[model samples]
Target: MTTLVYLETHDGELTNGGLGLLSKAASLGGGDVAGVVLGSGVRDAAASAGAFGASTVYVVEDEALAAPLPQPRVDALEAVVKESGAENVFLPASVLAADVAAGLAARLDAGLNWDLTDLRLEDGELVGLRPALGDTVLVDVGWTSTPRLALVRSGTFDPVESGGTAEVKEVAASFQEFSTQARLVDHLQEESSGPSIEDADVIVAGGRGLGGPDGFSICEELAAALGGAVAATRAVVDAGWYPYAAQVGQTGKTVSPRLYIALGISGAIQHKVGMQGSGTIVAVNKDPNAPIFDFADLGVVGDLTQIAPKLTELLRARK
Candidate 1:
């Protein structure tokens, strides 16, 4: 049996969300774990799979994968499906991954489970757990079939060691069809100024209560003082208060930074599913009963609007 996790990139760099999904795949994956790599650095991305618990890394290098389009990933992942006797397939819960997982399922004559919050092996069968109705309730996976496809919400899981020497295998995966209709538009890569949130030792994340885009500056000030990166919850991302790149939650990125600071977030289950794994958690929210406080190691009930500037000033004075 094969347990495969499809990976994506952020700013052309490998995404930690994919790595975290692979970590979950390692546990549910009964046999060989295949990490399907697509895009520019297909060959070089093998090391990262090992770190996330994939022993066999399958690489498919093609320019089409440069963008996170469903067709390319669908084409590439199908190639892996054909070659490996994989009974299960996993992908991260991003716009691209979700599209591809569903499309791949249709193409492979299989079934798919999207945004799974939990996974387990039951009576020798793969089990999937996910939230329905905006996470107010969880539903057991309804689909069960050969090569079961699961879309894992980012930040909901921890991966184990893929458990051996990394095996690099290159395959012939193509997304040629898409190239015909799609124009080769020019693309520009953004250079991250400091340690990316994924790479940061500490992260200060703000939510809706920060008020708006302006609120992040307070987080920026604190993050800068602590030499960390600034992140945001989905509410902030959905509110357009911050760039989609900086969002952290079920639908956003996954980070295992040393410290994760949440300001004004109420800690929705979907949001908590993502960052609960951080080593240290500190929350600043006005509502004392906010769910974020439940998972937070340290919780302070206060207004972020009032406290953020003060915190920033305090940090400035420290330096």
Candidate 2:
């Protein structure tokens, strides 16, 4: 079998999630694993995929792909899939990736398995593990047709370097008329200090219990002191107390930090699925029966307003 891993890039660098997926495809080991990079000025980023375990890197550099759009990418990916004769295609979940995967599936009339958390080879066939029934259980999923497409959940795998190199093959870019019609007008980057939640080793998340937007000051201070990042639950984001980019839950981003501190969070199943992969979980809530306490490694039944300030003070003092 031949597997094609889509290596998504941003600002001329490969995304950790995409690289991690590439490493996973290589580890499966039953067949040759290749990576396909689609973007303008992405040759350097494509070359780096070899270190993460892509034996072959297909590059399609075109001005049409300069902006992170799905349709043009779908066109490029389809061309590469046909050229490579790949039986399987894998992509990490992202706004652009999700769109591209859906478009590719529709264009190729192939089967797609999405929101997958894990994948393994069984009897020389690929099987994906998808969370079902509110993420309480994992169900096995597979495609009955060839060129199986899968979109995995973010942060499900970590990139491992193999100190190898890939054979770079450039492919000509071609796009359907409808795909090239949409054009990017302006791009604005979010201004943030410190590590992003996805890359942070520690994350301090706030929820509805924080009272309001200002209540996140304690979380910010604690995250700053711990050299981490600040996150928020879906409820907090929906209330406009925090930016949607910082939200963590079923509708938000998935993260697997080394340490996760939940303040005022009630630990709804929607929120738990996003951060359950953290190495160490700690919760501080006044309610003793809060669901977060059930899974937290260290649960403190107390008021977060008081506890969080003291914890931040202690952490800063240690520095």
Candidate 3:
């Protein structure tokens, strides 16, 4: 049985969350732990993937692979999937991964599982766990067909060192024109680089209940105090109160932090779907009826305007 994980990377750094998926997929089967990496940073990316248990790394290089649209990488991945005879495909529950997974599943005629909270192999059959109907219920997914595919949520599993060297092979191809409708007219990357939100030690998230843009100041204060990053809910981002990059929900980044502190967020399933797996979760909301309280390990009921500033001050004093 062979399972392949699409390794995610940016610039020259491999994604922190992708390593965890490699570790999880490796535990499920005993075939080649292959990785599909496309970009100029393939060598470093493949080396790091090896520490996470990858045995084979296929490098597909092309400028168009990073040519604004990711359809080329999806095509490259599909070609590799067919040639490698991969039985399973795993990817991080990220925007790019989600897009690539959708395309790959459609191209391969395989089932695509999204944002899996739990995964296991029972008697050579694969199954996944995820929230259903807006976090109101849990669903168990079983693939009845060949070459199973899943997008595992970040932070659900730990990445461990499993000493192995990945054999790097090159695939030459010009991937574009497949999805020609979407053109790459704009290109931008993050100016500041540090820890990714999903890999942070702490995350302080703000929401619309924060009242206004000023509400994020307190979140920043707390995050700075804790050496973490600031996150925001979909409501805040949709309303233009926060940047899209800061959004932490179904439409934003999927994060798994050591400690996630949510301020003024109502526990919408879309928001929780991406961030329910923190090591410790704390929430502050004015309404005790807020759904976020249900999954939070610690809850504080109060207006963030009054509560957040005080907490930030107290934390700073202690530090």
Candidate 3 structure quality by residue, lDDT tens digits, 1-319: 7788888777676776778888888887656788778776466666667777888887787666665356876778887887779888988877677888898888889988887877887776788988677666889997867678898765566787898888877877545565545667877776634455766889999988888888788888888888899999988888888788888876677778889999999989899877887879999999999999999999999988888788778888997
Per-residue lDDT of 50-79 in model 2, one digit per residue for the tens?
999899999999999999989999999999
The candidate that wins on TM-score is 2
What ranking emerges by lDDT with the best candidate at the front?
Answer: 2, 3, 1
lDDT of 2: 0.94
TM-scores for the candidates: 0.82, 0.98, 0.87
- Candidate 1 has what TM-score? 0.82
Q: How close is candidate 2 to the true structure, as a TM-score?
A: 0.98
Clashes of 1: 3
Candidate 2: worst-modelled 10 consecutive residues by lDDT: 245-254
| lDDT (Cα, 0-100) at 101 in candidate 2 | 95
lDDT of 1 at 4: 83
| Span of 10 residues, lowest total lDDT, candidate 3 | 173-182
Give lDDT tens digits, candidate 1, residues 149-219. 98877656554554466687888886656533555467667665668876788999999888889888888
Cand. 1 Cα-lDDT: 0.79
Per-prediction CA RMSD (Å) = 3.2, 0.9, 2.7
